[model samples]
Target: MLITKNIKMADVIHMNYFTLSVLNRFGIELGFGDKTVAEVCKIENVDVDFFLEIVNAFVDKDYFPKKQLQTFSVKLITDYLRKTHYDYHQIKVPEIESLIEEMVKACYSEKENLVLLKKFFNDYKQELLNHTNREETVVFPYTIAIEDAFNSKTLDNSVFDLMETYSIAIFQNEHENIEEKLFDLKNIIIKYLPQPKNSENCHKLLYALFSLEQDIIDHSRIEDKVLVPKIREMEKVITKRFGEKK
Candidate 1:
């Protein structure tokens, strides 16, 4: 079901608990006693439109309103992306690592298997960290700069200089398939690894991996489908305007 502003906030949580993370990213928490999404967002000083769009997108896999999302300012999109990164780095990654560690300690027979699993996950973690680092430090800031330059009447040489060397297309091309390795990691747990004596940790690890995989997929979808296209269009405009002078 497509969540609307008129839907009860608590009801939305009942529908998809995963949205709790989405709500938290927006600085919203539980305790809104039957208030609608709109009512709660208004009280919380959140962008109701953006909230609705993001929540709806997350709730319904088929309902990515890319055009509507693209209408939002780059700052808003980048802010959400940064928050998702925070969730991954500060919460999801460590939780998964801990689960893996517990699983490794849970069994003795599969020590070698567990070690190999650890190595695979460590490599995946490093790649994910590096990927997000590039986006946060380089790609996002560059897009924001393009946004700034595109909106401004005064053309600057710096934006053009940056443009000469980089564009959203370049970033899009370089964007690694970080999720592929993650899928492999999940397969290693599901198909290859022997179950530990305390199988709970292994189960938890698989669940965590699946959750993280979906979260990253959704996050990347926003970037690939919405932000990348938006930035590319902006880049075209800025380059055309600035390229005329130089």
Candidate 2:
């Protein structure tokens, strides 16, 4: 739906179309990568002159440091996860839980419906909680170790290889599992929280589900597109160093 035709850089200074799209979708966009203006222009398919103009506008007026941007593949994933998904979980979990309890209270008179919804909520909570826990306990630690190895020039026996062979498989499998559960839970919410012709609580629950759905989709997109590639790149660096050392 975002057309790329005839939009001048001067018209939308300080934000690219990509940033604008993400901002409109998510309510805010983070900073750009450390890539040069030329590299950004190539990726966005904008003219160099226009891209530079936009960058200069952002730098002059917006005060964003292009040098400190997250340009590298690894840094992008780390930064995106920290800023977006991590923040989403921190805010959404308690908010959604409170609403879920309200839903339980409102639907208590409907014993069967309340019980069903409670069960679904329990499963949803567990799935997301486990996913976050794994990232915190295992994946992130391994990623940090890989980065340390990369930085220290000690690539042999790196965690990067282990993550590539095992951690990634475990994470991807868990993602698929969680995706299935989320799809099931989405249908349950739609069926149970359908827009009431006369009920406000029903409307509230529906909106909550919609927002949570969007956040989950965004979280998964960042993981699949950004995180996995970064892990693989770390693996490549480790393997290359090991070979050179041999």
Number of the top TM-score candidate: 1
Tens digit of per-residue lDDT, candidate 1, span 1-246:
988889999999999888888999999978999899999999999999999999888878888755789999999999999999999989989999898888777767859888888888888888899999999999999999999998999999999889888888899899877789889888877887777788778888888888788888889888988999999999888878876877
Which regions of candidate 1 are displaced past 4 Å?
243-246
| lDDT of predicted model 1 | 0.88
Number of backbone collisions per candidate, in order? Answer: 0, 2
Q: All candidates: CA RMSD in angstroms? A: 1.3, 9.3
Tell me the spans in candidate 2 whose CA falls farther than 4 Å from its real position.
1-70, 73-76, 83-89, 156-169, 177-179, 192-198
TM-score of each: 0.95, 0.62
lDDT of 2 by residue, 1-246 (tens): 121223442334344332343332223223434544444455555445433432343233332323322234354345445544455466655566676677666553555665676677777777777777777777766766776776775555646456556655567676654556556665766664543233666566556665566555555655665466666676677778877878
Among the numbered candidates, top lDDT falls to: 1
